[model samples]
Target: MSGFSRSCAAGLLAGATLLTTAACGSGAAETPPGQGDKPEVVAAFYPLQWLAEQVGGSDVQVTGLTAPGVEPHDLELGIQQVTGIRDAALTVYIKGIQPAVDDAVEAETSFDAATAVTTIPAGEHAGEEGEEHGHAETPYDTHLWLDPNRLATVATKLGERLAAADPAHAQGFKDRAAAAVSALGTLDQEFAKGLSTCKTKTLVTAHEAFGYLADRYQLKQVGITLDPDTEPSPTRISEVAKVAKAEGVTTIFTETLVSPKVAEVLASQVGARTAVLDPLESKPSGDYLSAMRDNLKTLQTALGCTA
Candidate 1:
């Protein structure tokens, strides 16, 4: 096996071993994948699930571990979910981002999408208050899906994996992945043009989830919280407020899944309004592309971009 494949297999084996030990006394058979001729594919979260659906099409049965509106970071895999992972023909996931999912799969046939793209170092953001609040720093930010180009890379790689798993539909997977990549390319261009002439280049978000997006668009992202669920320290809040005022930021952005109270308070302190700038974690509505475009509109309005 190739290095990547070996690593994935190792992770899956580790997860399966743990599950076996934990459920030693349980007299339940593991639930099998969907009963059909189609290949069963398990995706760790919404973004991977969406990619699998687009690429796998009718040839594969794709299941998402993280539900809509659920925070993937805090996901705890149930026994059934673990069984689903173990039984899948193929599993696609990013390692290190979701520990629970990573520890549940016996990914004999699996793909780690994070390996396909360049990763930004985690904990690079200023005013990170989650560390003080008992959240450990992630070595790398796994939110590569935020950047369309990176996601396109992942889609291409995933297509290759899906094709390998279900060779009969290889051509179909390739075709769909190409189309998806093309769409992502267009979206990337749109973001480039839209933010090219923005009045301000700073983005202040509720959490440090927008680093990839900011890097892609050449804007600076200041996160109010390091962890989405943790509240920022009083000093951190004050620091963010001062930065907002100094930058003349018109809005402080919050996400859909998390409460906006913190953002509201920060915006109030800085005399700025609060707006929803979804990270596409739960996808309040629409697919990934539409949600990203909606985010583009929000960013354009807040940054006063010409496009």
Candidate 2:
């Protein structure tokens, strides 16, 4: 609510182009007159966008920057998207995910979700681009959405921020956030119970995006590649194969956005099959809850969890 005016935001973009890309490129669509007098909340990608919608409820106008099926890493922002960020009351983002979105958000209106939780150290990543090409922006991994408990914490904090932004709808924001937290709590419990009796604890993924999930569920994640879009080197693939074979890994997990060729090759090398274990970087077929539930079933089957 206390950010740049429309005229001020437009004036700031002096040399902006005529063609504009909507933040709601997918999953989320803009609402008619929703943000006209309401607080405008801009989310860098799907998860944050979904959170804003859940927590802000109908009190805020939510705009998701990333489209469905598009990878959020290294996303390119257009003039309109940048303008929207400048004009928004709050711009929710994970700093290391999209470099373009990282640079576009101003401190006054920006809320980096990664700051809401304690982060783990970055893993050793060796892809075609080498180690530096990975999550080097922050010391910690930015894929915090994998853990339901941590995401619930973010939901609570986001609710507080929304309340602060729009005092008139303060109670509404807090109430919605509480409901989201309760839902996430239930999901976390399901994951804990479902993954408790897995025969194999090692998870092989094409991208090392599941560190948080692995940490939460007490499973080991052997990622073939470190960064998104970067190809895995032969040596790295071989290394993971060795680990997979040794750990009795039955499946090499793939994601929606990234190519599954590497995962398929690894699966063959380790004499295992490939399964889709969404890291949730983009919009999923269902919302976050449903997709995560699907992932739970996939993990239980892949890990051979009896319980």
lDDT of 2 by residue, 1-307 (tens): 3542334334223112111444423322332333345556777788888899999887766767666777777467665556656766678998877777778788878898999998986665632455423266676878899999999999999998878766778899899999999999999999999999999999889888899999999998888887756777788888998999888899999988888999999888879999999988888888999999999999999999997
Q: In model 2, which runs have C-alpha deviations exceeding 4 angstroms?
A: 4-35, 126-134
Candidate 1 per-residue lDDT, tens place, 57-124, comes to 88766766666766777666656546546655677888876776667655566687878998887645
TM-score of 2: 0.89
Worst 10 residues of 1 by lDDT: 23-32
Best by lDDT: 2
Cα-lDDT of candidate 2: 0.78
TM-score against truth, every candidate: 0.85, 0.89
Q: Cα lDDT for residue 263, model 2?
A: 95
Q: How much is the lDDT of residue 117 in candidate 1?
A: 91
Off by over 4 Å in 1: 1-35, 125-128, 131-138
